[model samples]
Target: MFTSRMFAAGAAGFALAAMGPAGTAHALHSDTFAADNAESAAVVSAQIADTGSLDGDCTGTAIAPHWVLTARHCIEPFPTPGGSVRLGQGDQQRRVQVDHWEAAPAGDIALLHTVEDMGLASYPTVSDTVPGLGAARLYGWSPDGSGKTTKLPVAEGEITELLDMSLFEGKQMINVDTHNGGKTQPGDSGGPLFVDGKVVGTLSASLGDDKDGMSDVAAYAVVAEQYDWVMETISGGGQGADAGTPGRGDLNAAWLVGGGGGVLVAIGASVVVLRGRGKSDAG
Candidate 1:
C-alpha cells in the first residue's frame, strides 16, 4: 500500500499542471480514456484475501481474449478459492471477468482466463520479432491505499532495453527497462506494458529501494518468447497442467503464505504446475 503522501507527492506535479477550468476539463477527459487510447495501454487487477479480509489491487492487461499476462509474483495463491479478475476497468471500477489463470514461474508471467469469453478482438497483437528501442506505455490502478478509494493512474515510458532471450537460474527470460522512471510498485505488479497498442511485456519488477530502503535494484520480466507456453497453458496443457487441482505436490500451503514473492525458488517447477491450472491460484 502506498502512503497518501506518496500519492500526493507523485500526483501533485501532474495535478498542478492541470489547474484552472480548462485544465480541469482536460484532466477529467484525460483521466477517462486518454491512456487507454494508446497502442501500448492495458488494464490488470486482482483480488486477494489475507488475514481473513478480501483485499486486492488492479494491474494487468489482455494479450488475448481469455488470456491476460502479468507478473509471476503478483499471483498469490490462496488457501481457499474465490479469487477473481477485472479487466479494462477504468476509474468507475467496471470490468470484465476472467475465469481462469495460469503462470510460468520461470518466466515470472501469469495468464488470466476471462469468464464471459472476451473475444480476441481487443487484445494487443505482438510481432514474432522483438522491437529494438521501441517506445511503449504502461497503465494500471495506482491505488492510493492510504484509506481512500483506489484511483487508477496511467504513466508512459520508452523501452530502453529489451532482452528477449536471457538465462536466469537455467530458465529463459525476457528482460526489459523503460526510459520513464515509472515502475511497478507492490500493487502494480502484473500490469502490462504496451508497444504500438500491442502486448509486449508484463510489469514484473523494478530497480529501487524497498519500503525499508534496504534493497536497491532494477526490475524486468519474461517476454513474448514464452507465448507458446502461455498459449498452451491457457489452452490447457504444456507442462504442469494439473497445477490448479488440489492434491498436486505443486499446490502446496507455501504458496498462500509466501505470495508471489516467495515462489521464486521453484519458478521452473511452478510454471509447469501453474500452466496446468490455467490460472494462477495465487491471489
Candidate 2:
C-alpha cells in the first residue's frame, strides 16, 4: 500500500542521507520560508482518502491553473474508490475539490483537475538543462500524523549519476542524492525535483529498508523527455498551451545510464526501475 512516513525519521534528514555521494548538505530546510512553501504546504495538509477512510498522503504539483500532477497508483481503484488531491499546505480554508483525473496507467503518471482555478505563486516547469554531477533539492510533504496538522517540507540534495534510457521501460527516471538528512517516502510520489528553479523530474520511488530513513538509491520520473506526452495530455489535443519546453541536461545520456533491462510496469507510461519486489499501490 502507499503509505506516508513519520516525522521521527525527519523527512528532510532521510532525503539527505539517501542522496549518497553527489548530494551536499545544506541549511535550506532551516530557512523560514521554503521554495513553493505556500502551495506545497496546502498539498501536504490536505486530507486524502480512497474509500470511507484515509488511504495515504499524496504529493502533487501545480502544472497549470487547475491541473495537479501525481502518481497514477494514488487514484487507481483497487477493489475500492481512490483518494482525492488537496492543495494549499497550511491554509485550512482553501480546499479545492477535484473535478476529474487523467492518468496513463502504464506510465504511473496522473493529472488532476480541480473545481476552481488555482493561482500558483511559482509553477515548476521542465528545463532543457540538467544539472551537472552534484547535489540538488526535491520538495514535497511527509505525513507524520503527529498532531492535528500534517506538514509538507522542502528538502535539498544533489544529482547523482543520470541513468540511461534502458533503465526505464518508457518514461525517464533519474537518480539523486539528498542533503540535510532528508529523503522521499511513499507519500512523496509525484512530487517535483527542482534544480536551479527548473523542474527536472518528479518524485517516483526511493530505496529504504524501513519507512524512516530512505536509502541512497532514489529515482524520479524525468519530465523533459515526456514533455511531448505531457503537453499533449494537458493541452487536450495537439493545440493547447505548450508545456514541452526542454531542459539543459542531456536526457539521452541520462537514459542510457538509468534505463537498461529494468522491469517495466504498465502505469500511464512505462516506468522502468531496478528489479525489485515491493510493488506498492500508487496511492
Tell me each candidate's TM-score: 0.57, 0.62
| Model 2 per-residue lDDT tens digits across residues 1-283 | 1122212122221111121111111111223224444334324321233331232345567665556665554454333323445555455425566656665534445566665666555455545545567766666543422111234466667777775532224345577876655544444566677776566666666534343334435567666656656655555532223244223232222221100011223222222222111123222
Q: How well does candidate 2 score on lDDT at residue 153?
A: 62
**Tens-digit lDDT track of model 1 for 90-194:** 354444554456656456576655555443234455333454565556554434222122345555565666533222221333334433333334444565656
Which candidate leads in TM-score? 2
Count backbone clashes in candidate 2.
67
Q: Report the Cα lDDT for residue 262, model 1.
A: 21
lDDT value for candidate 2?
0.45
Candidate 1 stretches greater than 4 Å from native: 1-42, 48-55, 76-81, 89-92, 95-99, 119-121, 145-151, 162-183, 210-218, 235-283
